[model samples]
Target chain A: EPEVTQTPSHQVTQMGQEVILRCVPISNHLYFYWYRQILGQKVEFLVSFYNNEISEKSEIFDDQFSVERPDGSNFTLKIRSTKLEDSAMYFCASSKPTGGNTEAFFGQGTRLTVV
Target chain B: AQSVSQHNHHVILSEAASLELGCNYSYGGTVNLFWYVQYPGQHLQLLLKYFSGDPLVKGIKGFEAEFIKSKFSFNLRKPSVQWSDTAEYFCAVNPPNAGKSTFGDGTTLTVKP
Candidate 1:
């Protein structure tokens, strides 16, 4: 089965540094999303992307965060300045909107550690 | 203020035991419900989903979920679980046309062999 793939299984960055998490969604998927889970916390939605643009975002996806579909296959999430609270596992997901198969397929996740 | 809730934080069970995990959402109107599982060090995998039609939906590995619209609940159930069934389970809800899914806190299940 085809799955979403994320790069850099783990990353450690200093506070105030920038980080880009990359993902390659399934080839045929049109909708992409970014989510994060703090330790012992629920998974939180950050942003959703469709048609190469952001369709929706959450409060956590403030000015510091941005997402881009830089190429035909690559989707990335960039954080301008990392904070200690930004440490979490970031997940990338993609889904098809048609045929009543809207369930998203998730990547293994990139563990972002801000020190 | 849409939110998903999973009642149990952690559950311990022996092999062959029946299992049920409670989940509820605050969203009304047209919504899609789903149950996902994450085994150790694995990505989230869709176990089952309820969009329309039957209230009870069966999924891979003998897992099933019931979407009770009246109670705003979509609880996951399994009969005679095995040790391999140990994993973290999450309940999620999303609007029909939206891409973002509201996920519950997740329930960690530990099945003893």
Candidate 2:
């Protein structure tokens, strides 16, 4: 089965540095999303993207966060400046936008660690 | 605010034992419910979902869940489990007409062989 794929399985960066988490969602999927799981915590939604624009976002997705589909296949989440609290496993997910109860597929996740 | 709550944080069961993971939602409106599982070293995978029709819904891996509207609950159950069933289970809910979903804290099941 085709699945979402994320790059840089493990990323470490300085607190004030920038980082980009990349994802290649299922080729045919129309909906994309970014989510995070702090250690021992429930997964939290960050943002959902569709038609090259943000469809929804959580409070945690503040000014510092931005997502873009720079190309047809890649969906990237960029954090302008990182913080200690930003450390978590970032997972990329995708689904069909047709919206008749479609299941979302998830990637293995990128473990972001800000020093 | 909409939220999901899973009552059991950790459960340890032996092979062939029955399993039940409690899940409840705070949303009082029409809702869609789902159960997802994450096995060790793997990404999260959907188990089952409830939209409408029969409250009893069966999912993959011989698992099933019943949605109780009045109780605001969707509990997952399996008559017998195997060691392969060891994983973390999450319950999620999306209120009617809402695009986003709220997820449970999750239940970690450890099935000993």
Candidate 3:
């Protein structure tokens, strides 16, 4: 089965440095999303993207965070300045626009460690 | 605020034991409910989903869930479980028109042989 693929299974970055997490969603999927899970915490929604723009975002997706679909297949999330609290597992997901009952497929996730 | 609550944090069972995981959501509008499982070092996979059909929804691997609208609950159940069923399960809720979903704190299930 086709699945969403994320790059860099693990990353360690210095505080105040920038990081870009990349994802290649399923070819036919129309909606993309970014979510994160802090250690021992629930998965939290960060943002959703559709039609080359952000459809919705959460408070956790603040000014430092941005998402882009620079190409037909690549979707990326960029953090301008990493913080210690930003360490988490980042998941990218995609789904087809099947009316009201769309189910999303998740990537293996990119573990980000900020020091 | 919209949120999901999973009743159990961890559960241990022997092989062939029946299993049930409780999930409840707090959303007033029409919502879509789902159960996802994550095996060790694997991505989250959809186990089942409840949209607008019958209250009882069956998913892959002989797992099922009942969507009780009155109680705002969608609980996952299995008649018998195997050691392979050991994994982390999560319940999620999303508004019909939205793409973002709110997930519950996952339940860790360990099945002993």
The lDDT, on a scale of 0 to 1, for candidate 2 is 0.89
Over B1-113, each residue of candidate 2 has an lDDT whose tens digit, in order, gives 88898999999999999999999899756788899998875667889998889999999999999999889999999999999999999999876444356789989999999
**Backbone-clash count (model 3):** 0
The two-chain DockQ for each candidate, comma-separated, is 0.58, 0.43, 0.64
Write one digit per residue (lDDT tens) for candidate 2, span A14-38: 9999999999999998888899988
- Cand. 3 Cα-lDDT: 0.92
Off by over 4 Å in 2: A99-102, B95-99
Docking class of 3: medium
Enumerate residue pairs that collide in model 2: none
- Model 3 chain B: which ten-residue window has the lowest total lDDT? B93-102
Q: Which model, 1 or 2, shows the larger lDDT? A: 1
TM-score list, all predictions: 0.93, 0.89, 0.92
lDDT of 3 by residue, A75-100 (tens): 99999999999999999998886778
Q: What lDDT score is found at residue A41 in candidate 1?
A: 76
Candidate 1 off by > 4 Å: A99-101
Residue-by-residue lDDT tens digits, candidate 1, B1-113? 68998999999999999999999999767788999998877678889998899999999999999999899999999998999999999999887766579999999999999
